[model samples]
Target chain A: MIAKLRQVMLVLAVAGLAVAAYLTYVHYAGVHPACTAGQSCIKVQTSQWSRLAGVPVALIGLLGYAAIMGSLFAPEGEESRLATLGLTLVGFGFSAYLTFRELFSIHAICEWCVSSAVIMTLLLACALARYLLAGGPAPESHSSRYSTGSSGRMSA
Target chain B: MASRTQQKAQARAQRVAEERAQAQRARRQSRLRILAGVVALAATVVAVAVAISAGSASSAPKTTSVAAKHVSATVNRLLGGIPESGNTLGSPHAKVTLTEFGDLKCPICRAFALGPEATLISKDVRAGKVKIVYRSLCTATCGGPQPGAFSTQQAAAMAAGLQGRAWYYIELFYHLQGDENTSYVNPGFLDGLARLVGGLHYGKWLHDRSSPQLAAAVSSDQRSAHALGFSGTPSVLVQGPRGARTIPYLGNYQTYESAIKAVEG
Candidate 1:
């Protein structure tokens, strides 16, 4: 189940990465995305919120999705799972915030942005479930850290 | 076995069990600590994200609402006595129509507005030989890169056109134009132009600027400019006896007139 979950997350991260990478490329290329709400896509993508500290948010998103993919592929263990959890939670949270901006503040939607956000949200859920089902940490490592040497060797 | 030895063995076994239990408790506490730390980190990330967006939301300074205190007397004399209606600034029956595709922030457009445009308005425009139509080209300096305050300024001017004071607003904007790449184009600038131009209803212009109609109008003008294949601001398309065609530089009064006449001929 954990392997299946990781595969699901890996697939999702790639989808999100492709979307984000496309957005970032277009942003620099000065090509407007095909929009739904008239010029809303143009308006939102070109808005000030699109960049932070001179870095395109799309680039940030690209890196984020890539990080999630990396963490998912890392050798499964307590550290790896914890890192994935941290990164995806941040991704999910930031995605939610950006979606709010797109709908309310920007008053327009970018299909790419929305798709990435959805991917992030789903990835977060999958990650959380996988982490819980995997049950805390790798027992070998956890037990070693708290080993008192005199306890029953068969902890069960 | 001796009774003392049996008691000692039992005591040792009990001690080991207690040690294991204590270790279990410590592990649980450590897990909770890590969980708490992760939660705290997530909270910090969220707070930072919101702050960055909020800061951008208010990146522009508090809008100044100063009305224009210095209306150009010369601008008035030049535009005065001209037939103005809608976005057109000349006699309705003129044989030639000179369409200006411009960004208010474009220096070239400003030059044309302060130079050739003024001449055309005073000369052929007043004489009923030519009419000028002010169309926005946000595709250029104004809309280029990003649709910042310059785009909004264009929209505001278009909205003012709805009230038939577009010409007034256009001329005043050129006269008061600032650095093309700065925050000079803001609500205060709009307010100032409305006041300087004197006949436009400030409230209506403000309301109309962000309206759907203005968005459509601005987009239409820009799209038309794009369709025409003109790449920059202050581009002219002359329509006359020769039909409508984009023309080259209207360098001076003579060049400007010839560009129009050449199209008319």
Candidate 2:
């Protein structure tokens, strides 16, 4: 189950990495994002919130997704799981902030940004579930020390 | 023999209990480490987020009015000898015309105004080889159709044109362009820009800015921009006796210079 979960996480991280990489490319290449939503993408990309401090937000996202992927390849242990959780939590928080800025401050929604935010949200959820399942107490017998029953609650 | 068996069983039980205790201790330690790591990471994320938010706040354009006399002097120095009638600047009989579709609130348009447009005006427009036209396209703000303050400000420029000071007003507005999302195009800001235009008559300009004709002119600029299918601001269209061509993007003044030459031939 842990291996399967790791595979799932790897897939998500790769998807996120692709999105972030594309946005970063668009940023540095000085070309309009391939947007179908009538300049909202352009407006959001050009807004001040598009950058953090001096670094482009897209570059930050790219580095973040890359870090998550790196952590996944580390020795399989509780430490690696925790690292993934921590990184995704941060990404989720920042993605939420950017989404808020798009809706409220910029009054424009970039489809690419929304897609990235969705990917981050899913990654955060998967990381959290993986963390919980990994931290469950080891079973002592067939009955198990901890197991989820029909009620969806952990049982001893 | 039975007593010996009991003794060995007791020792085995003790050893098993000790092993379980050690395993539990290791698990507890690992959990603590993970918890500590999470807390530290969360702190760093919060710190970075706060820094980003502070940077964004500071990045908002400064709205405090610049010194009127200083702005007027600069505007005059740059646009002094040019003839501006309505939205057109340079000699009326100039063979070539370069029309710029721009939004006052657009940062990119502001860059063009400060860089290539400035050079084009000083060299070509001043020398009677070109006449530049200021047309409106709300690329960066105001969404669409509703116009809001974007149309109001564009209409204000058209009104300045009525007094033959459109270029002066356009240059000054771009000089003080603010955050696009901010409501900086109020009456005070518009009047402030107008005051910086050396010879603009405040009363007549104010009255004309609210006129229906100016409003239509602003709308007409939008229609023209749509007709040309311009998707962005500072979209330039160069025209001469040969033909008219719209610039695909804002590259540089040389792009405009070349296009003008192409049409001139």
DockQ values of all predictions? 0.18, 0.22
lDDT of 1 at A145: 40
Question: After superposition on all CA atoms, what RMSD does each candidate show versus the true structure?
Answer: 12.2, 7.5
Off by over 4 Å in 1: A36-38, A136-156, B1-25, B61-187, B190-265
Q: Model 1 residue A7 lDDT?
A: 88
For each of the candidates, give the backbone clash count.
0, 0
**Among all candidates shown, the one with the greatest lDDT:** 2
lDDT of 2 by residue, B1-265 (tens): 5478657755765676678778878987888777777967866885788676657554433334455566667778888878878889999999999999999888668767767788888899999999999999887766533348777899899899998988888888887765576666778888878877777899999999999888888888889988999878879989999999888465466778889999985
Candidate number of the best TM-score = 2
State the lDDT at B131 in candidate 1: 90
Q: Residue by residue across A1-156, what tens digits does model 2's lDDT show?
A: 888988998998999999999999877655567889866786787666787875889999999999999999998887798888898888988898889889987788999999999999998888888887887777665234222331243243
Restricting to chain A, the TM-score for each candidate equals: 0.84, 0.89
Instruction: Compute each candidate's TM-score over C-alphas.
Output: 0.52, 0.66
Over all chains combined, what TM-score does candidate 2 have? 0.66
Off by over 4 Å in 2: A1-11, A73-80, A129-156, B1-33, B36-51, B54-60, B65-96, B106-132, B137-148, B158-182, B191-216, B219-236, B246-264
Error of model 2, residue B200, in angstroms: 8.6
